[model samples]
Target: MDGTVDITMPAELEGTRAVVRSWLKSVGETVRRDEPLVELETDKVTTEVPAPADGVLLEILLERDAEAEPGALLGRLGARAAEPAAPTAEPEVCSRQSAAPAPPALEQVREHRLSPAVRRAVGQHGVDISVIRGTGRDGRITRADVDALVAARASAPASGSRIVPHDRMRRLIADNMLASVTTAPHVTAVFEADFSAIIAHRAKHKAAYERDGVSLTYTAYIVAACVAAMRAVPVINSRWHADHLEIFEDVNIGIGTALGDKGLVVPIVHRAQELSLQAIAARLHDLTARARSGQLKAADMKDGSFTISNHGVSGSLVATPIIIQQPQSAILGVGKLEKRVVVREVGGVDTIQIRPMAFVSLTIDHRVVDGHQTNAWLTAFVQALESFGD
Candidate 1:
């Protein structure tokens, strides 16, 4: 008897809880090696598990909505077996089929080229693209086209309101946010930081960094400054505990990357204190690109002592009491940088001039640090940015 191949979740998943969203093939279905077999959703991204070998799906060990972690078994395959036994257990969803009618011949070919959203909607609702009028330019099919089709397929929602269920990712984010708020006493201190020196520095080297294939962003400068500030106030890179505060020697900084309607993910720049500005930018670029593309591994989001939320990119001037990532003592929120008038002295004369400025706030867990320490950390952080290239 040939041994069975286990279809398990990959071990490299990090930071957030993961759960099964759906399975691609039902038990007893023939599948090829490396085919996408199941969809797994995490707090940050949705990924697929591939079949280990050419075989029949012999077991459905875990069903949809079940929590799955590294090495957790999802199902099994009877490798190299032409005939496999029936599944011992299966969910009712296994026998369910899409309600929509089959698409036209041309539409069957078009299915291969639809956007991810369209493809998903088409699969779930058995959408017939032949009926969905394209609203995109040049008669292209947009995600909205499939969406409208899906909406048309459903009956009118009561009171003109449609019900949208929370996805696994959204639910995970909600639980984490609620738990963090309840567990940690969040206190915020706002401080203004002048970015003239760093702005000048970025202006000088940004093109060169780009030539080397790295995007030199102000956030990289902020991360470097945060590392410097950590040196001045190590307690800021710490965790709160009932018995004792845990301060980490390594400065792994997690930057909050928003995913719009999908919530947000924090991908850590591991050992940030040890990396140079350019290195920090490169790591951040890689992590952020992967984050947007749903490609970050669990290790990329793990082991952060502190976090930074650059909400200014989204046009916010300032956001107070930005929720801290639990187990982290503090989080830094950098606001929008803009030109502002300020008094300056030149040649023994007082003059008004426009300077680049931003509000940098530090939100700390009271259990880990007090006001003095929080302000001290922000002071150091501001100094690092303002004093750069001087």
Candidate 2:
């Protein structure tokens, strides 16, 4: 007298397929209709999948941190009554986990909660789970935990065969790279900017800025410059839609942050055009810290007008960064700041002096923008940084 209900993937998120970040309901747990059963996450968003009907969870079709496609069966819901199947309803059946599924080895079981990234890393690296010690909150396993185990084993000259599995993020990153390369015809433009004025400005006011409880950084300077440039050349803040182009009026900048081995996340600084330099610095600090902590919300990744990846933070001289290919036209990258000597006209005479400078690279969808517009945006950005006063 039991009937099965299927949980189908939502349509709007077809391109943005979901991954099981966490499973809230387990087998045999009775769930209410529309109750959240699992958490799904993409690179840009995370959301919950609701129950198909009021029933008991019979089986989880996928494991935690597994990839799910749109319209794919997430899990099975079993009802006590053999209710008549409604028209246009799809029958849910559990797919074979493997042709010959076997229970996992005892060593495969973990004693502590492992975050999705850690779990995926362990699977990919084929690390022995028994030796990993969790250092995260509540002794939860982290990516560092897995890496430490791998390093220790490697240093010990350990000899053991293991099969690892790639986590959902790695898989997603792979698919994303493929889709982006295939979909977007990318073009890049590089230019160097003099940061003498901005550096002097920071040196002159950084202490007072800190006194106001704000950390003054070159990032704030870049954000301010980007805001001015976007205002002057709005086309750089646009998106390409089929048959037409869509331009965003407000400027929200997405900052690419590397969370070490955990992975990369871009937390958007909302309404950046409306904030002062100090305010932008404060918010950038907050968003980046949260992003590194894996605490960013789904809404934080939504609606970015443009993106900035400060690759120079890691000492890169320059990088042709890949675009996030969102509802945006372009992404800008800032390289390492280094002191270089350049000629300047001083007192109507040529002079050679050292100045802190950086290379800026902009990657845009060339189909929507041209070289002139791209360079113009970069020119305005450089001008703003050079002209800002303390």
* Top-scoring candidate (TM-score): 1
lDDT tens string, model 1, 53-127? Answer: 888889998887788866788999985555677798965674356576666677666666464545776788887
Model 1: clashing residue pairs?
14-298
- Give all TM-scores, in the order shown: 0.82, 0.70
Q: Find the 10 residues in a row with the least total lDDT in model 1.
A: 135-144
**CA lDDT of each prediction against the hidden true structure:** 0.82, 0.76
For candidate 2, the per-residue lDDT at 365 reads 84
**Model 1 Cα RMSD, 1 decimal:** 9.1
